[model samples]
Target: MSDTGLHPGLVRPRPQRRRARSRTYSATVRTLGPLALLVLWWAASATGLLTPDVLASPAEVLRAIGELWGNGQLPDALTTSLTRSALGLLIGLAAGLVLGITTGFTRLGDELLDSSIQTLRTIPFLSLVPLFMVWFGINETAKILLIAVATTFPMYVSTSSGVRSTDPELIEAMRSFGMGRLALVREVVLPGALPSLLAGLRLSMTLSVIALIAAEEINATAGIGYLMSQAQSYARTDILAVCILVYGLLGLTADVVVRLLERLLMPWRTPQGATR
Candidate 1:
């Protein structure tokens, strides 16, 4: 014992242990806030402070959702809304990535394209809805295009910024090794820009959801927005509440999926204090 080189008291706890403790604490705080809000909501409803015509109680909302689910209405509406959002998001993401990469990587591309994109971006995307409706009609085409346009700007901005911010030193080092343009981009530029690109994806997903909701409200015969419109006309507060909850859940779910994808694709990125 006397020959021991170090004291046990001098040892530090493992980092994973510390991280686990912090994660548990943060999770508790997150749960507590939502739990408190739910309690307040239940209390207000039980006390009859919230009028049925304006706000439905949690129980009423639950029953309404159950009825809709049992009748297959909720599932059908969800499918329509989700399909439009997914298709629009894919189209937007592809276009944005190509344009961003071209402009970020070449002077000629930037000169020819960046100014036009910037000018268009300055004009509010939503303001084009009336024009889109006239051009595409109030059909699925208009709705999908509206969501796509709304989703594109964030991706373009973020990806361009990310690619441009990549280290010149890394580029030089890769060039010194006689790396081809494709290899340099694949190994250096894309890896370095991934974080920003993923952030943009998350933002685009959120905007797509919002734009889809608004687009559907215009003349939708099927989808959650249409359900809400019908519920409003009938003063069906329970159904309205259910629709609101579903919209929120969809947005939250999309954000979570994007974050998970980010973590998977960028495992080398530090994990602490990442935003929602």
Candidate 2:
């Protein structure tokens, strides 16, 4: 009898032990962890570690969200923020892809734009909010532009790096096949750079949101950022805390959505580093 293969789980009891440990670890992280933090927070609040007027407990934030939901302002705020973020993301991504691909492949373009972009990235995004306000005014245009400008550099850097990092063997194979320049870029470079592009996009979203807040606090009538600013003016720390929480959740949601997209687009990849 020739017994050829055994599953790792069948070959050794250790795999089952490892599986159990993994599940237990995940459960501990997901279930018990946040509850423990919540208790610590409540204890601190009770002990006056935080002034209730200036800071909020988790329960207060939840209550504030519930009140906003009941009042129908939450959805409006969400819509405004999401629309601005989406428009900025689209425009920024389009320009970044072009700039990155061009600069990555051309010595002339790299020499010209690389240092300029690096220098631009060194400047904090919030510094540009006032400048954007002066140039574009305090309309939706200004907010959208602020987000776009803030987001562009991350994508640009990631795109260039991703293009440069395309597997040399793959590029060699494509050249060996006598593919044209455009064909090589289309078939190899863009696809190879998607993971890094997504990562850049994730970073861009964070910057975009922060920029949105700084902009909306100036002239916007609606948005989570606008709402947060309003809450701040009224000294409603709980409401402001909830807005911050919502921002965190939204950021996490975007990341998860991008991760799912990466898995779908790069099915051949292993668990780690599949997108790039």
- Return the top candidate by TM-score: 1
For model 2, the superposed segments whose C-alpha errors exceed 4 Å read: 1-33, 46-51, 172-178, 268-276
lDDT of 1 at 263: 72
How much lDDT does each candidate structure score?
A: 0.87, 0.80
Per-residue CA lDDT of model 2 for 1-276, tens digit only, reads 225466544642353222223545654766687688779988888888977796888778788889999998898999989898889877887778788988886678899988898888899878887788788888899888777888788889999999888898998899999998799889998888888888887777777667666767657888998888788899999988888877877777777777677778887665442222
lDDT tens digits, residues 108-148, model 1? Answer: 98999999999988888778888998999999999998888
Cα lDDT of model 2 overall? 0.80
Question: On a 0 to 1 TM-score scale, where does candidate 2 land against the true structure?
Answer: 0.81
Model 1: clashing residue pairs?
none
